[model samples]
Target: MGISTKEGLDIDLYQNKGRFLYKYAGSFLENAVKICFKSRFPESGSKRIENSSGVRPRMFEIDCLVGNDAIEIKWRDATTDGDHIIKEHTRLKSIASSGYKPIRIMFYYPNRSQAKKIQLALSDLYAGLGGEYYSGEAAWTYTEMRTGIDLLSILNRIANERGVS
Candidate 1:
């Protein structure tokens, strides 16, 4: 008998094609946030830096930076890995240390009955992570949304009052 690389599997186990949806989902969310803020207030100064190829690696390049606020938009699939947790830890630390407010907006793909429960879960996770990573005042808010459209009014208000704080 000859050696078989495929073994008993009918499909290739290792492939990079599956990640495109995640990438697209992230871009879609970023654009949706940007559009929402811009449409509501024309001079909100909201910009999309998600796909920006900066001169150097950004230590904490959030999705949208308006005024003194750093907004991070996440498109989650009901699962968070270690790397994601660590990255958020560092990102929030960087934002706070840089004297900017850190605002996290998470969009969960899976629908659940109690949105409050999901929000509380995320808030608890961030609370622990923020406590360990950030030393300064944690004056940030963790918002969980079932859909990107839910962020329109909230983001608009944040962007509009960016300079106030």
Candidate 2:
């Protein structure tokens, strides 16, 4: 499993405004995913969250932890940002392989089309990643969203594709 924590998690962004921005976006998405996860799998534990008092990783700290799950979230804003997704995916896989119950490597691009470009480009980054043909009535809600979606399903889909889950 990932590092056992006495509390939930601790994020330590380096910039001054970065901290505020991180919390704003992070809180939004966390709520969104928590609802989705509970609706689909009520038995699954809901996310338990915590933050660091100050910035600190020291090369040995988690960014965010949800229950027994550990996650590291990042954003990419550039003409070409494929590498960012690859790096995050690899890191999460490594953590999972090491025995973490659920390792989430979430990457999303925001207000920049609210995630349209990111969703369109998701296949480009995850070449072998499979899809579930999201044809639900509320498909459009997640089409260009950065804060809503089921992380477990996404990870399970990808993990099953790579023979991980």
Candidate 3:
């Protein structure tokens, strides 16, 4: 055999591509979620196209024509592991044989730990350069979506076990 190098199966890609551009990544994932809803929604008539409003009800309307239910998009870099990403996806999956699909779109971010969390709290970040939602409801349950990896889920699970005690 010849001398082997670690270049082929190396996992150091993280070091260089650490922080990702959420604006770019969000656009890509937005397209992916759009296609998913379009295909899964119930086909009462020919499918139509539309854009995003960053709300659940907006997604539910399309689900009526198709079958999708919701769309959750996330942009991350390095903190959220690939495995954790997949696990978090099951939040909307069916557990019962007769259960309906509650999920429309569940986008994920691969590595956004040390960066800003994934919640829709602050109206705008980076001194408002990234922008924020100026209209509509000021506070929704969406605030809980702020956790990075499993922090949110784990906290929820524990609190649930306590049963408001």
- The candidate that achieves the highest TM-score relative to the unseen native structure: 1
The numbered model that scores best in lDDT is 1
* Positional deviation of residue 121's Cα in model 2 after best superposition, in angstroms: 4.6
lDDT of 3 by residue, 53-122 (tens): 2232222222222233232333223343444333322222221111322222223322344322422222
What digit string (tens of lDDT, one per residue) describes model 2 on residues 19-74? Answer: 66577655655554555544554554433322222122212233444444443333
What is the RMSD, in Å, between candidate 1 and the native fold over all Cα? 12.1
Q: Would you list the clashing residue pairs of candidate 1? A: none
Residue-pair clash count for candidate 3? 12
Better of 2 and 3 by TM-score: 2
Candidate 1 vs candidate 3, TM-score winner: 1
Cα lDDT, all candidates: 0.49, 0.42, 0.31
> What's the true lDDT of residue 104 in model 1?
59
**CA error at residue 153 for candidate 1, angstroms:** 12
lDDT (tens digit, per residue) of candidate 1 on 1-165: 563767524234423344564677467756775666556545554342322222223644555565666665555434444554445455555666665566655555435535444445445655653422111112112222212244545655876889533
Better of 2 and 3 by lDDT: 2
lDDT of 3 at 108: 37
